[model samples]
Target chain A: MAQYELYRRSSLGMALTDTLDELITESHIDPQIAMKVLAQFDLTIAEALHNRVKAKAAIKGHLHVYRFCDDVWTFIVDRPTFKLEGSETVHADRIKVVACTARAPPGGKPE
Target chain B: MSNQLVPSVYTYVIDEVCEKVAPTFAEMGVGQNVLAELRQTWKRKIASMRVADFDFKESFDDGYGVYDGAGGQYGTEYYGGDHNDSSFAAAANLAALASGVGGDGTAPDSYHIPQNDGAGDEAQAETSKVVETAQPSQREIDELVQRLWQERHRAEGEAAEEQGRGSLAKQRIRQLDGVDDDDDEEDEDDNEDGIGSDLDDEDSEDETADVSHIILCQYEKVNRVKNKWKCTLKDGIITVNGRDYVFNKAQGDFEW
Candidate 1:
């Protein structure tokens, strides 16, 4: 009985703008739309992150997903050296992260 | 090509240009030492920009010999004939079309026939050159930096969260093992009650819930694989290998 919905893929910035546009255009926006937008944002951000990590040959960070309004949201950041298995090398001084989420409609599934 | 040093810092080879040919133009007004320094600086900047990743070779070599230093992988670039009078019409058209440019020469407009006039061709050529020249533009650098920063941040958060989850799981496991403290027992009851109320609200739409549906979305980020969940429910708990996972009342969606 499980159903699935797919959203278009785009950059994090574009996804944010799209979500805002949808909200403004449709007075009664559905959670499914928000979920799709946020999922897309997360995927784009993750791909960019993965590419960077591969290019630099360094362990970049981790992504966190949490439940929000019947959907899931992801936040990404760099892993600290101390927190890693091998703390003897590659110490990170500071890091940054991006937060995004996917929401489902009142009676729909979140993706 | 070996003898005509273009004296350019860029490690790329222009179509027929070689690095050996220090342009007579570069020598006339500029002192030889100054020109050499400029070339060195250009090389350093290119290095900083990491153009090597794009396969830009150091010099160019044609049968007659190199002129501008064009040995690297040829990339789309704008070549200008007259600086001020140059038009990227052709290049722009090509680029526009390539970039999915539409009708009104603007995004969101209907597609139109691309300009095919001389001016249009020149313009398009210019666009091609400029696009190559601007490869590692400031905007690109900023984007790279921003992405890297985000990965770093996400990794940190995940580590912390996983640690927290592990601890919580351990605490719960211990309590379930029947060696729980009074406090632990109380928490179990509280959780059950709370979750039960949530379930009651959820069951109102049980007719639409189904356990067969599950969507797992995973992606690589910051050199790590991350998993995201998507799920909808009907009236039953999704038992995966004898374990139940919480899901909402909607259908699941995901992509590989």
Candidate 2:
């Protein structure tokens, strides 16, 4: 299955890349192995989020900009407020939302 | 909250990736030890980010205790008093070396001079000739030129220390010490302002543009009416206010 690579831009992904880079620099692993590891990460992160995470959130904002391209939607919101699972909330001056198509492509679902 | 679940979700991802990659590592004939090290390093790096309270105790015994102790100490003193003392000592040593070189001018050049006959005047003339030469016989000349460069550098350093104590010299010392938190804050503010002003510029075209706050997810549906919009996003990762949150679903409402 070809998992979405969206979450690879997260901090967790950045940390993994940094660790892999260190190992590559030390000659402990080849770049090919690192690529495999990252591919595995893409799969694992998607699955973990799907199966393990159950929390829901609500976001309210003023949409500054929105674009739909290449089967993805990008929204730029100003002064957004996110109401998380609990009563807790988070506020930010601005946030960019990148949403890929949720429908699984044919033959792309994980077994 | 969704942010509270981030630590466990990240932990699960790390563990699952490590376990799943084992067969590939074995097929490639790479040692399993390297795979284990990769797992440890990945966990350590993520933990260091301090985004959430990650439970590293379950994976390995040697991970959390030592890391927490060392990291705590580093965060407390490494930037405050200890670093200042070390940098001050280093600057003092540099000043002493400069003074030593200045006080005994012939000391640095003594070893560079060839051991000629004990004729002081002739040896001096020989040294002058060596300095004047631009030929392939450059070992001695190189050493003399290096000494001259060091002398010039020391002179410049002393001058900077004397005249630019509040501005250039202190800033240099602060840079060396890596303790300029105010400067870093100012830099971040400037960057944010720059990004805000150029929000409509071509730089926003990149999918992975460096926006400070972002959400990456898959959308189930997005409906709009007039100026109102609603989106149902799934498997989303949200980063806002320097914190990370993950959710299975998010309902967003906004108006253009």
Candidate 3:
């Protein structure tokens, strides 16, 4: 199961991701909690490059996912290239390969 | 939003998105360069104009979303005022009561809730923002890590905290749940084997484990000094430096 967080975003589609040196994505599902809650959902992560089937165009290094809906995009990825500042990597942030996951309610199953 | 061009990093927009390529860029994780490739600075000036008419409700699944007495998919966030007043735990508890996922938030006959916490399908799903990210480590890897880490701790004589070594919630997840059939039996076996740390009532604290929140319980570290080398006895086979050594736990020593 993916973790959930209250994220502040711009209407144009950007989280105040680096506000006060915090990545908004980190606030989503906790990496450990994700294991049990997200076991059922089918998931995939394709690199943006060399894959034409992921989206309408090309994106480099972006993860390719086959979600039932378009709404579930903002993933809880471990700060890949977006290097963190001091004390950021001190705790859980040091963990590698954190997966993003979220389970939807019954009513909103994608069409 | 476009004209703002507030320099920093970690920003995303759909207008700049090229479906196929964008998803790949998204995989690398967000950065200024990724955004540079995705969004042209020349067109960024229109961001403010583009967002002028942007509506929160427009992002919702439908005009008004419905809850199945379980989780509610309200679409992208619609945060207003100070949302910090409500915690995920509180929201989960409230949602459980409202949706009746588990009538009293108790462990029902099914393995609905991962741990004994009142959190079940509804609390675990609805309030949770179901973002579609890549799969992290596989279950096999998780188990192996758990096993190897435990073995390493034991070999190092750092097994005092036997109950709280790894993610206990993970060990409880039922691969094929629904009825309390074979999983229950396996759960019991796990409890006895000492592998399933949470099965024991003594390790209940592990249930309260919340790796989700930023305000975590930073346990005091015990920097102890000891010999780095150890004699490991595994499946009666102990590989040393490069040679196989015969380990005798009773004798508390090893022979080459």
Candidate 4:
């Protein structure tokens, strides 16, 4: 699967970046190495999610804004509740969804 | 339960990335210890986020998670186990600490007496505790001030450009400046909501301001009719409430 740069915005991604930043700042690793690590992270996280996670979530929200641009869909929802399996729920004041097209465009990068 | 999967998924990602990058590190002549250190540091940072009980190592459990739990427990004991009393004390201590460090030295003598109690080891422990709590608040205040300064600079930059535009555009810029100021005020109010609430407040602010609560996944189909929308998203990493969840499939229903 082609890696999307989108997952880099998650907390897991941010934590990785912060750690890499500290390493770079302290001369523990080169910037180039850090970039390679991040690229690897992008691929690994996508595959791990697809292969390892079996959970499903149901989201209900008031859609405030929706945009389809460049084969990606962006949804801004206000006061969203994510109901996962087993009655677990997560509530947020607002959530933004960025979904890449599942079906790869012909001759384009597959998501 | 989905949120519960975060730690393991993250751990898997971290381990896999480390493994994949090992050859590169060796090729670059970087020491393997640094790779191991990177893993440790990454895990430590994630643990500090307190999204869940990581429980990966005894050291992390003792170092960060237990420190947080102990802080709360200490407050409860000090305030006779009353939640409201403990929170009020925590707020007062935060205010006193903030003013003591950020402003003039007039933050009431009562708050300073403990620091000057001269109880030897007891005094040292109390001072360290104060420092431990003070550091995060100081960092947050610094960040908020930096953001406000940046916003001011941006508004000035826009004003300079507005002089070349029509008066209508200038009015629009002014309105935008008003909106920015309102948002700043709201941020300040969030900061003042109390020390205990600060973490959650900052998280939500990050979510809204930086679009942190986002899902990056592949959509199989997204259909809409009237004001209703439905979508089937798969292989997504969803971040909400400062925790990450991975879902193989997600069904979204929303009304505009």
Candidate 5:
């Protein structure tokens, strides 16, 4: 449980890291040794996208709003604990990385 | 002639086919075969609807389950009826089918329930009198989207682990393990009915929960014309009709 705390984090960075952790937990799962049968599945592909609109910023020059859905492999998550989903974008200047998180559904976290 | 027996007979034939074929495919472990058989069963029922002068789309509603309205438009929510019997039925059926209890078009000796005499007529009358409404609450939709999103992560993480990416494998392992923890937390949060109280309880724990989570996006095919929405989730994103929707489980946040 302690090892998986990174995945259950609220931060985007930690969420991404947690995705990897989840993968490890699912692999080579033995039912007799554990509580239940393991649900063996894989995550092969993922698409991360960001679009941003900023209202107020310190240095306002021609801020480039680029559709960044294209770049493949060039972009990487700094943190693995965080898990990313859905369609979203971020607005910033001089930013090294932009990570997107989904809007939590109208209800709360799932039961 | 005001004959209701024709449609009922056709439904019985179709049900017979489904009752025979669905289990066989399950035992053979061929999902496509099962789907094809189910689709045929649906087609047969559709014919029954046509013969009875009822709208096929209206009565059958979606392929997954029957909706609660006319024109199959409103009240188009999930299957919210009796789960106890179906759960047992589905499980028993699956086990029997998986064990090769019967062959194609052969009714399992053990699987026979009484037929409904007036059920079809009542269903027909009910369909004519009601208009469809959105039965699922906003919360139900959200939960559906969330569950789908979680599935996406499980899928992608497994793929990464297979490729021997040590880090990716480790991450997936952690998430899989976390499911148990979350389940415990969820149980604590769940109401007696077990709807989605775990989500409601997350607000207080949001800060402590890690925020930097990885999102998995999954792509699945959905056919609106067929009243089918197939989806797979990965990296927190759900793809249906080639469009993307996100599922963020983090607390006090909704955009991903």
Candidate 6:
């Protein structure tokens, strides 16, 4: 998890690695929570992408924020994941940037 | 009393839900195919939206099945109100064609079912499908690309040997294998049918220039297009519009 960075310049030129660094280190977002969220993402759409009974959106988002091409996709997990050091539990919101190499279907929303 | 939630019960309830919802929904002019396609599309959409561990263990038109393990089972075929059994992507591809959204013009025919001609029976085949959902890693992509490249060269070499030399087979092998691009350049000039002219290098280009022109650039991680023409993890290569392009499992990018 530590070895995997959220890809440099992810989400249309957004500095994802640098931003993740700030969110985790400077902004004090828990590392465990953040990575877990990303891992979930990797497991879901990122994973199972290469093959399917159907052609899946390699990148699919329900909550489309049409603002920044740099807008980070984020959502909180429902169940408790990791226990914080002080008996507090953490459920990090999974996050990713839309930088799909696949072109969206015509009239389809931009990544 | 707790054990009352039998796997069959779960299966029955979902079957009942579809049996009820589909017909009523069809009354509004939504055909069974569109309804089911939309159903699966939304199912996937909702699944993608979730940030937690969630599984509906859905009762699809073919049957109901549990995930991470196999327990519950049901078939909508037996309890049908409206049954249009095409996968969402396939059905939607058809719909897109009808609506002028663009598609391959394929009529919806083949749906995903286990091929029984394999060395396994139905259960074994279904298990294989369950296994395929795992995400492909970079290692897998690399191996596939390398293997495809090797396979192409090997097949070409075999054809070259079997078909004998001095014919167009040898020329194609030379082109695909990058052995001797300039060997037949003078002769190919006179043989101006453009039969094997794609091998000719117009200008001094890098190593990749010899190989088929990259039609599409596939990646391990899906993302929007980028600037660098650096090496990409191409899944497979195909000829489109007389030039070669690489493609991947991602559908609808086919510009043929």
Tell me, by DockQ, which candidate is best: 2
| lDDT at A82, model 6 | 27
What value does the TM-score of chain B take for model 6?
0.19
DockQ each:
0.02, 0.60, 0.03, 0.54, 0.03, 0.05
Candidate that beats the other on DockQ, 3 or 6, i.e. the better one: 6
Q: State the lDDT of candidate 5 residue by residue for A2-79, as single tens digits.
A: 011111221222222232233224442122211110101110111111111111111111211111332211111221
Score candidate 1 by TM-score against the native: 0.17
Task: Name the better of 4 and 6 by DockQ.
Answer: 4
TM-scores for every predicted model:
0.17, 0.61, 0.18, 0.62, 0.18, 0.21
**Residue A107, model 3: Cα distance from true site in angstroms:** 30
lDDT value, residue B133 of candidate 6: 26
Model 2 Cα lDDT, one tens digit per residue, A1-111: 337777788889988998788678768789999999998888888888888999998999999788898878989887899998768889988888998887753336633
Candidate 6 lDDT over residue span B130-201, tens digit each = 346223344543453354445445555555566565567656666766645565565668556443343233
- Compared with the true structure, all predictions reach lDDT values of 0.30, 0.74, 0.25, 0.73, 0.30, 0.30
**lDDT (tens digit, per residue) of candidate 2 on B1-256:** 3878988899889888999999998998889977877787678767767777777746554754554464354233533555544443443344456556456442344423332223453446466654454132335434545555587587666665667676587677768667577767776777665653455363454443345588988888999999999999888888887788898899999999
Estimate the lDDT of model 1: 0.30
Off by over 4 Å in 3: A1-111, B1-9, B12-15, B18-77, B80-187, B190-256
- For candidate 5, give the docking quality class from DockQ: incorrect
Model 4 chain A worst lDDT run, 10 consecutive residues? A102-111
Q: Which ten residues in a row have the lowest lDDT in candidate 5 chain B?
A: B247-256
**Best-to-worst ranking by TM-score:** 4, 2, 6, 3, 5, 1
Q: In candidate 5, residue A108 scores what lDDT?
A: 24
**Poorest 10 consecutive residues of model 6 chain A by lDDT?**
A7-16
**Greater-TM-score candidate between 4 and 5:** 4
Error of model 2, residue B86, in angstroms: 20
> Which prediction has more favorable TM-score, 1 or 3?
3
TM-score of chain A of 6: 0.27
Instruction: Give per-residue CA lDDT, model 4, range B15-79, as digits (tens).
Output: 89999999999999999988977777678777767666676756654543554364343222333
Q: Per-residue lDDT of B1-256 in model 5, one digit per residue for the tens?
A: 1122323333343444344444444554545433343343344334432324323445454542431232132122112433333443443444344334323333322221111122443344343322231133445435533544454455555555567666676776788899989888777766644554553454323322212222222122111223222222213322112222233222111111
